[model samples]
Target: MNVTESEIIKIHNFIDLLNSKKDSIVVVEGKRDASALKKLGYYGKLCEFHSFKGLINFADSIASYKNLIVLFDGDRKGKYLTSKIISRLEHRIRIDLSFKRKLVTITKGKIRHIEDLSTYTRLDRFTVL
Candidate 1:
């Protein structure tokens, strides 16, 4: 499926949010998600949660960081994990849920996560979200 120009723009703006907060750590679903963000030129610190336990542990560890961004997949599992992580770390970290909406809307019925998005769209084509 082809991504619309507006969608690409939105994705770029999302990416820019990450870029602007260079010191903030980005939490994702898995290594693939991290890889996808990295391929998009996101060089900030990133942590991947392969499972619920990992996510909780990571959240606890990063409680000291004032800025934390969770960039999970748009699927059911991702939403569940996001909620859990937020519940665990909401006190100490700043969270951005905007990416979730943009990702879900852009992906529509095609892809479920960042890794899948990277697979379907070339990195160069991505602009400011």
Candidate 2:
């Protein structure tokens, strides 16, 4: 699996962007999604959807944050959840699906959740190698 230098830089930039937003809440679908991000070295606050009482309450809780990154999976259910969140959050949220979409497309069906992002992207592989 040969990754281009540009791709490496892009991944690094993505990591940097994420790192820069240390205080921004990362809205994920479940504990697995949050755990996957942790495995990739993201230590920011995570707003888990499953733990929330409801969508309205969840959106209200994070309304205080000026910026947010929503990293939902690209699957059917994931897409629906993402839409709902975006609709509820209005315009204060940033839906970052680039990494997830690329991961799924590259893996060719190996992954379907935020939890499996690292395994497919191998973004860590490039850095570690």
Candidate 3:
């Protein structure tokens, strides 16, 4: 997979877009996923599934938030979780999957998981051959 400099720049811009959403909480699957987002300079609220007591509790905890951005991995488990979260909280919270959609679109499927973002965070040394 060849990642051009232009694509990297676009991804950085997308990260900036995420940073702009300070009020929205971004949900990822685990600690590494959260770390990846931070490495990419994401400064908004980030929730990790592993840190919660359970799905129900997690949903209930963030119920008060107006917006949520699910950045779960693109694998089967991640997709399942995303669906479950949406079904559980769709009526209560404004779940924004657009960021996730834009991420998959911008990366062209290379970023199947949030943790994979680490590879692109370091702009100066990024090179894929």
Candidate 4:
């Protein structure tokens, strides 16, 4: 991956934001998305969208949380899910979509899926040492 230093800084800033909002639950489409965030050093709570029986059930499950940081993929399905979730829970709790938006901005349109977030980071097959 030809990741520039500026990109790494952006990703670090994103992760820092996640850390700042650590009290909120982070929602993703699947386990891989959650895994990527974990790999990026976010040790906070994570809920996978697919793990729920349905949208209502998902909402019910997470309704108790005071805040939620949604990070669904930026595809058609993801957008649909995001809107549906917002519609259902907008009155219930604070849903923050800023994480997803910042993720998109940091990747510069190169990455659309949360699972592929790591692709924007530097990959070194062998360290000099």
What global local distance difference test value does model 3 have? Answer: 0.85
Model 4's alpha-carbon lDDT is 0.81
Worst 10 residues of 2 by lDDT: 1-10
Query: Which candidate should be chosen as best, given TM-score against the real structure?
Result: 3
Q: What is each predicted model's overall lDDT from 0 to 1?
A: 0.72, 0.68, 0.85, 0.81
Give the candidate order by descending lDDT.
3, 4, 1, 2
How many residue pairs clash (N, CA or C atoms closer than 3 angstroms) in each of the candidate models, in the order given?
Answer: 8, 0, 0, 0
TM-score of each: 0.76, 0.70, 0.91, 0.89
Give one digit per residue, the lDDT tens place, for model 2 in 1-82. 4555555455445555676775577778888888777766666677798888788788778877766777787689888987
lDDT of 3 at 114: 91
Query: Largest lDDT belongs to which candidate?
Result: 3
What TM-score, to 2 decimals, does candidate 4 have? 0.89
Q: Model 3 over residues 1-129: C-alpha lDDT tens digits?
A: 566677787787998898888668889999999998898778888889878978888987787678999999999999999999988889888989999999888889888989988878765364552
Model 2: per-residue Cα lDDT at residue 88: 67
TM-score of predicted structure 3: 0.91
Of 2 and 3, the candidate ranking higher by TM-score: 3
Per-residue lDDT tens digits of candidate 1, residues 1-129? 676766666666667767788557778888888888887667777887774367557767776677777788777898898888778777767887766666676666556777875753484455443
